[model samples]
Target chain A: MTSNASGRKNLTFISRRSPYGSGYAKACLDMVLSAAVFDQHVTLVFMDDGVLQLQPNQQAGDIHAKDLSAALAALPLYDVDNVYADRDSLTRRGMFSDQLAIEVRLCDADKIAEIIRQSDVVFTL
Target chain B: MTTLHTVNKHSLNSDLLTSCLRVARGGDCILLIEDGIYNVRTLEDLAARQGCELSGLQCCVLHDDLTARGLAEKDLPDFISAVDQAGFVALACAHRQSVHWF
Candidate 1:
């Protein structure tokens, strides 16, 4: 699982669920944070309904749920900087990158594959 | 390195299969398990609907799950293979990593 001489393993987390639908999205985020805290190289990819979690101005307070976006915003501070969103998913949802709550690198199918290929572990939810 | 993408939900009920196909690449293996076996019946149709090409992609369905769902090997399409439990483990070992789409 070691990609390089450094002891860090590449961990890729693919979040494919919408925020607040269930605990899947939140649970995945928790895993990502835990992995990052352990000093593993983390990559987060948002695709399918998971891209919906990136939508800005969420009114999650009305539903009595913690704001997922706020947790996501803290990812950068944790050194989990390899953030990406599927381009096709965003387009299918009529969401522009500029409209997302946080900045992320946009990736197409091939690019996504490249990232997954490089990863030593892939977590999906 | 190749990734083994496992899909466990039906496309009609969930878009997990479609989402799995979106990032699956050539040489990567896609194994359908549980309700995902239903995807073998309409994989091409769904891929076409989503405008995703399946060329050079390896697709497989769990034989046990297929049988459990009342499907037989004879009913499978030419492009997809029916793998047994042992084959499933082999596929997982063959790939560098695995991703589950549920």
Candidate 2:
């Protein structure tokens, strides 16, 4: 068994689902954020419907809850700055870079596959 | 590389199983936890008839979950291995990456 003594581990969180509708997305985000708090190098990739999460100007008021948009705003402060988005997904959804609050790297399908192949750990929500 | 899948939903509609199967590579393993255990037979059958090679792939179920669901090892297909928490960690360590399917 190889020891994880290298100290630096690449952890990627794949959020394929939307945010806030189910506990899955929120829980996954919380865990990744917690891992980042411990100084782990965390990468959060939003794909498919998960891209809806990074949409700007969202209000959860109708659902009677605090807006999750605020949580994403703090990601950089936690040093989890590697936030990515699927380029095809955005195009299919008719969304543009101006629609997002966070600056995301728009990757194609092939790039998304490459990212998953290289990650030390991937959590899908 | 081995991939550990943490499945929490039992419904067939859950894309957890399909997504995992699609990305699984040779020498990789899959563990069915929570409600994910139910997909063992489904996956095996698909692999057999559809020519989908789960090459060097092993399926595992969480023993605690099976017990809680009143299911026994014998109740599951022969392809599934009942594992404990330690086994879960061992599988995770064996795999290059881990994905949680909820």
Candidate 3:
């Protein structure tokens, strides 16, 4: 059942936009889940404004927007457990992994670049 | 080793289309979605204008996105193909790499 014969690869989905600014947050999550359903090895990276999506207690009632962080926390259920957040971005925003709803490994810029370089396919939203 | 490059902006509003064309390799696939369809009519014109040397590069647009923007199938240029969500996923799997330009 391995994708090795088919050469399926480590797919990277980068979410660099804010959670509430546009539909990009949902789009990025959808892409990772869809790719995972296809048995692709998927990793999700949140950087820049993207890290803001992981913030806790986001009440978007006024905008009637869905809670993106809730869905982001459900990635493991979709088999997309490789989630990364930029440390500098989180710090710049005065945030930490403890403030996020999901379990994400804090990575530096170099590590983030390494993930991009190693992925067979990357989708940035 | 062709890259399946996806640009989500329109040519008129952003240089992404031209930039993608500038760096595209021969036979590379360019999938335009979201506002990118707004530039479909200009592909031939863009090629001529920039003299982009990449040959046989396949250009496509997402059908659903086009409709969301009130563009129909007939609105797409003859040279540009319309692909669905599944086709988009398949396109990524078919290519060596997939890059989405913001």
Candidate 4:
């Protein structure tokens, strides 16, 4: 699945579950970081209940859960900056783009479809 | 490149199918396995309720999973076809990549 001169593939990760509900969110994050370490072009799309992971002021410690926001904040450092969130998902939950803890490019259904079509590999978790 | 999007959850238990259908393109294929086979009878209704267009998409249900779930090929909508294990493998070979949505 290698593409481009540098051998980077268009890797897309779609996170659709709520953080802390299970290990899926954390595992997905770990996989993304790992892919970035390999110099792959990683794109993360947060949709469905996954949009809730971007909510600010999360006190995950009270629930004995790791701080996902802290991990999410490290995305830019890893150069995995192609972050997106489904517009419909955010609106359905009454969340606004400005309210998220991190900056994410909001994508409509059609844009998301295009993203998938362009991906060389897609991981949905 | 075409993608095979596989969903493994029942419609009522999770919105994985809806989420998968949202981004699935025209040439992409959707395979329902595990509890996802439970959606055989209501896939069209669910898609309609979510405003998802399935006109150009190829929908399939795993035959083994359908049999295990006590469903028959006749239960599937005309838009969907039953694929055996070999057919599933053929689909994987035909598609550029496969995404599993649970």
Could you give candidate 4's per-residue lDDT for residues A70-102 as a string of tens digits? Answer: 899899999988999999999999999999988
- Superior by TM-score: candidate 3 or candidate 4: 4
Judged by DockQ cut-offs, the docking class of candidate 3 is incorrect
Local error of candidate 3 at residue B91 (angstroms):
19
Candidate 3: C-alpha RMSD after superposition:
8.3
Clashing residue pairs in candidate 4 (N, C-alpha, C atoms within 3 angstroms): none
Model 1 lDDT tens row, B1-102:
888999998999998887787778888889999999999888999988878778778999999999999999999999999999999999999999999887
Among all candidates shown, the one with the greatest DockQ: 1
> For candidate 3, what TM-score does chain B get against the true chain B?
0.92
Candidate ranking under TM-score, highest first, comes to 4, 1, 2, 3
Task: Tell me the interface RMSD of every candidate, in Å.
Answer: 0.9, 2.7, 5.9, 1.1
Q: What DockQ does model 2 achieve? A: 0.33
Model 2, residue A72: distance off in Å is 2.5
- TM-scores of chain A, one for each prediction: 0.95, 0.88, 0.91, 0.95
Question: Candidate 4: which stretches are off by over 4 Å?
Answer: none
**Which is the leading candidate under lDDT?**
1
Candidate 3 lDDT, tens digit per residue, A68-115?
888887888997878998787788788877878789998875565556
What would the per-residue lDDT of candidate 3 be over residues B1-102, giving only the tens digit for each residue? 566889888888765676566556666798989888788878778877978753578888999998899988888777788999999999988877777777
Model 3 TM-score? 0.57
Question: What does DockQ give for each predicted structure?
Answer: 0.86, 0.33, 0.20, 0.80
Reference-based lDDT, each prediction: 0.90, 0.73, 0.80, 0.89
Error of 4 at A11 (Å): 0.8
A21-96 per-residue lDDT for model 2 (tens digits): 7876677679889989876778888876788888888788878866676787888888887888877667767889
Clash pairs (backbone) in predicted model 3: none
Q: Whose TM-score is greatest here?
A: 4
Candidate 1 recovers a fraction of native contacts equal to 0.94
